[model samples]
Target: MLYDLFWQPFADFAFMRHALVGCLALALGCAPIGLFLVLRRMSLMGDAMSHAILPGAAIAFIAFGLSLTAMSLGGLLAGLVVVLAAGAVTRSTQLKEDASFAAFYLVSLASGVLLVSKWGNNVDLMHILFGSVLAVDDMALCFLAGVASITVLTLAVLYRALVVESFDPEFLRATGGGGAWAHFGFLILVVLNLVAGFQALGTLMAVGLMMLPAASARLWARELPAMLAIALGIALLSAYIGLLLSYHADLPSGPAIILTAGLAYFASLGLGRHGGLLGRWLRGRHLEA
Candidate 1:
């Protein structure tokens, strides 16, 4: 039963093996970033940024067809542009950072759709909108793994600064610790991961993988380290379940993976030990009794 359910699928298909590895890499890189995003109450930023990269990718697609280098470069450039422009708007106007991000992403999303629908075919648009892990080639897998490795290393270096800034930016700034650079670096990492992930999960569902597992972990852990670990576990498990569902049920791979994460999030909401609704209610009843 185990082999048929788990091992057989992978053993039977090379695409399955490749997809599993890609998902593993994505989870490893995105989970910690997702956790930090949640802690900072900037969860939607992931979604926004995902969309914000679409225009560049779409333009690159129009200009260069399916060239991976062009797509990556275009997406990175577009994401950085949005990030910087949003920062400028925040600094120069009364609008908050989130508001600025929201405005920019809306424009970016619309522009991307317009470009793709106008210049590209349905297949091109679909690929850009919803990625196919089954299509992950050797080069794509290497890209995913490299992004994960860099993300892990960068996060390790920035962990202390990130934690401090997430909780209290003023505190990080007051100590002459170059919190600005850390924040910029973190944003760069976020864009890099999203750009890499968009190839496998697509723009629409990429943030779901990043956010859902992290949100689920948030309900189960009080400490950052614990939350990070829980999110990683959930992400890995969701990726496996999602890949199996995609393979067996003929569902779209990206949505299947994200739906698995959604399941974990709901389960945590109801049954998780820390700060879960059930746990909170049970404790309240016990205290009253």
Candidate 2:
């Protein structure tokens, strides 16, 4: 029964094996970026970038006829454009950061939808919007693995600068610490991971894998390193269980994974030891006594 429940599907199908490997790579690569997004209160920013990248991929598909490299480059450029334009607007105008991001992404999303509608069939559109993880090819797997490797190495190299910028940007800048470069570098990493994730989970769901696990971990871990570790672990668990649920329940793979992460988030919200509702209520009751 245990083997049937857990190992049978993967053993019987190559696609399941590939999906598991892809999820593992994503959990390792995207979770840390999601942790930083939560810590810096930039969850919405990730969402906006995810949406913004769609138009680029759409254009690439329209022009190059489903070339993965073209679409990835297009998506990367679109994400970077949105980040730069939003950041510039936030710094130069009275518009706040989130508002600026919202403006750009809304425009990008609309444009992407229009482009997809005009140039591609519904199947192509669905592939871009929801991904085809079950149909992942060797090239896609290689790309995913490469992105994960690069992300992990880059984060390790820039850990201290990113930590300082997250908690104390003013201090980092005042100390001549190249905070702007660090910030740009971080944003680039976010874009890269999103582009990589887009191939597996679609743009709409990619950010969920990153943010949901990070948010859930935030409820439990007080320290940065702990939060990153917990978030990665939660993400990996969610990916595995989500795949199992997808196979058994006949659910959409991407959303099943995201919903699993959402489940973890809600569970953390209520039962977490550090900042959960139960913890708060317990402290309140103690105070009353």
Candidate 3:
């Protein structure tokens, strides 16, 4: 039964294949970064940065028409600028990271909306906001593959510095390595993944793709390496299940994928053995008797 449903979609429709492949690439690229973002308490930063891409995307569309490659590059640059500026503002002022992020994201979102309205072309707005995974073409797929490869390679090469800087920047500095550079590099990776993902997931939910699986994994794992593995597994599973659901239900792929990740998060919260609601409830019952 299951094979019958998925076989037609996979074999007959090129769009279905594109969507599945694109989502898988997003999963792999996002999982590790998501885990680190959670560890560094920068999950909100990821969210902020995702939304900050909207203005850039709108401007790119206005200037050069609906060119996916150009818009992706423009969005990437905008996200990077916002994140860097937020970091600088936080370091130089008394405002917290979350505060800076919230402020910037709101401003960017409003500006993006206004720009799109001023351009007087409302045709592609839906694509920018909600995403159109079924519209993925060969060029977009190639771009996604390249971005994913670069992101993975950079993370592998900088793994040690990233780990040290994430867990203990002071110790990394004491060991004669500059933690700031590592942080900057990690932020760049985050921007790249966000841009790559935007093509399928849109700016609104791009950060959710990066965050939910990793957050779910944290509920079950105690160590960073284990958490990373679990996060990756969860991300992949969510992508597969989400794609199937979207195919069957005729729903939007991005939201379906995000909802699948959210379901995993809730399952982890409720049933995980380490510190879930069920675990706490069982312990309480045993103690009461």
Candidate 4:
């Protein structure tokens, strides 16, 4: 029963195998990016970029009729534009970054919805918004793999600079470091991963995969390296169990994976050793004793 429920789906179906591979790749790529976002309090920024890519993807679909390369490039350009515009709006105007991000993402979301409605069919829109993981082709797989490789290597190369910039941008700059470059590089990685994630999880929920595991890890781990490692493990486990559930229970794969991550986050909230609800309660009881 266990094999039938868990292993058979993947073993029997090529699509299932492909989906598993894609989710694993997403976990590998997005988890680290997510840890940084959580640490920097930019979880919402990841969500914004996910949504911001939608209009560009929609435009690409309209122009090229579902060409993966075009849509990916368009999404990348759109994310970059939103990042730049939001930064400019925050720095040049009096608006805060969050407010500017909100403005930009909302506008992008509306534009995407309108474009999809006007130029595309429900099938196309559904695929873009909710994703069709079972339909992942060779091209999509290559794209996802490339993004994962790039994200991992880039994070490794700039690990120290990113850490310093995240914690002390002012200090980094004062010490004659390229904090701005690190920030931009990190944002670019975020965008790239979001685009890759959109292929499997869709625009609406791609950031969920990134943020949820990272947030859960935050509750359980104290150090950055521990958090990153824990986040990656949680993400991979979520993907594995989520795929099984999606197969046996007939759930949406993307949402299933994301909801599994959510469960981990909530579980960590209660049971994590670092600062969990149970941990704090136990400490309190010990103090009273």
Ranking by lDDT: 1, 2, 4, 3
In model 3, where do residues sit more than 4 Å from their true spots? Answer: 120-123
TM-score of 4: 0.97
**Model with the higher lDDT, candidate 2 or 4:** 2
lDDT for model 4 comes to: 0.91
Candidate 2 residue-wise lDDT, 1-289, digit = tens: 9999988999999999999898889889999999998888999999999999999999999999878789999999999999999999999999999999999999999999899999899988888998877777777788889999999999998899999988998999899998888788999999999998999999889999999999999999899889999999999999999999999999999999999999999999999989999999999999999
- Tens-place lDDT per residue, model 3, 154-236, is 98988899888878888999988867788888989998998888898888878887999999988999888899899999998
Cα displacement (Å) at residue 21, model 1:
0.6
Candidate 1, after superposition: displacement of residue 225 in Å?
A: 1.1
Candidate 2 regions exceeding 4 Å error are none
The C-alpha RMSD of each candidate to the native structure, in angstroms, is: 0.9, 1.1, 1.4, 1.1
C-alpha positional error of residue 268 in candidate 4 after TM-score superposition, expressed in Å: 0.6
lDDT of 4 by residue, 38-65 (tens): 8888889888899999999999989998
User: All candidates' TM-scores?
Assistant: 0.98, 0.97, 0.95, 0.97
